[model samples]
Target: MSQMVRRLNDEIESTANMCVRNGKVELLKKVAREFRVEQKSFLEHLEELEDHIYLCFLTINRSRRLVVRLGHTRSPKHQFTLQELNMFYPTSKRIEDPGGT
Candidate 1:
């Protein structure tokens, strides 16, 4: 009877250990799946940011090209007055005379 009890206890302990190992494996699988999902999301955001950066670069290049073309077309003697420059880019704040003279 004592031998039988010992055998039963050994079986129970073995089963418990197996269950613990299986639980750990399942937990690891879940964590790995979540990591894959987060990595995919991060990669998607990175791709979008790359696209946006590419568009910004294209816009800057186009603007630079336009400036170069305009500079070539305009006569060297033709100077832009402050009023003419302001017509293209208006100041948000009025310029106040510091001297008050």
Candidate 2:
């Protein structure tokens, strides 16, 4: 599963690059369509990395960076470093009985 995600990540990065270089902006949807599965699975990694970054940075710089990209900017190449890396898994869990049923 991880291998698949890595492959997809590569594909996504390459495709995004192509979009910026050749200005093939329309190809994004197709590229994203093919990379959905990996994106969905990569949420945990994204969250963990974000937590680590937050822990590492203890200044106004981090907040400023986030604020700059705080908008519906779909153009991934422009956002670069702080693109809102979305992971499509449910992070919240429900409370239930701890039974071996």
Candidate 3:
């Protein structure tokens, strides 16, 4: 299991590296379309990913790779504070409700 997860993480990091070479917003669009992930969903991952790569990590889903961030960002909402990505962004489970998972 650990081996599989490590491989999945590797794929994600590589994909993210390619995206970064492009622009964050542009890459966000590309990843969403290619991966079938929502735009906001991808953005939340970026929000979690720090400008630096220190926090980038990978996880495997089924046989696919997913890169996640270790850092947290402030919510540009009506206020600013440390926020979780899943909290502000919509996930596969709850589309767009911060309150839901």
Candidate 4:
């Protein structure tokens, strides 16, 4: 079970790498369309991680990789803060309420 979960994690990481190389938003949408089940499973695995240090390490590493792949962007509009994200972006579960409360 651990092995299978690791493999699935690797697959999701690969997809994420590709997403960073391409347009992250577009590639993520494509993945959601094509690999919805795997995407959900990967998220579930992340949620299951019990160790804060390990989870933070993994999250930071993945975020760094994505940032590096993004290269240096000249446009400031592409960048968003956590506050803006929290204020504006809606989760998949509540996408219907995109207007944000």
Q: Top model by TM-score, which number? A: 1
Give Cα-based local distance difference scores for all models: 0.65, 0.60, 0.51, 0.64
Q: Cα miss at 47, model 4 (Å)?
A: 17
Per-residue lDDT of 1-87 in model 2, one digit per residue for the tens? 457569977987887998978978778777668658676666778777767767667445665565565544545455533124222
Each candidate structure's count of clashing pairs = 0, 0, 0, 0
Query: Could you say which candidate leads in lDDT?
Result: 1
> Superposing every Cα of model 3 onto the true structure, what RMSD results?
19.8
Q: Candidate 2, which segments miss by more than 4 Å at Cα?
A: 29-101
Candidate 3: where are CA atoms >4 Å away?
A: 29-101
As for TM-score, the candidate ahead, 2 or 4, is 4
Residue pairs with colliding backbones in model 1 are none
| True lDDT of residue 47, candidate 1 | 78
Q: Where does candidate 1 stray beyond 4 Å?
A: 1-34, 77-101
Cα lDDT tens digits, model 1, 26-101, are 7556655786879888668767877897888887787677667767877988775444344333368544445764
Clashing pairs in 3: none
Give each model a TM-score: 0.43, 0.28, 0.26, 0.29
Model 4 C-alpha lDDT per residue in residues 1-101, reported as the tens digit of each score: 46767997899889888888886877687777877768688667666774665767877787676566554542555775444334333464323334564
Worst 10 residues of 4 by lDDT: 88-97
Query: What CA RMSD would you report for each candidate?
Result: 20.4, 20.5, 19.8, 20.8
Residue-level error in angstroms, candidate 4, position 68: 58
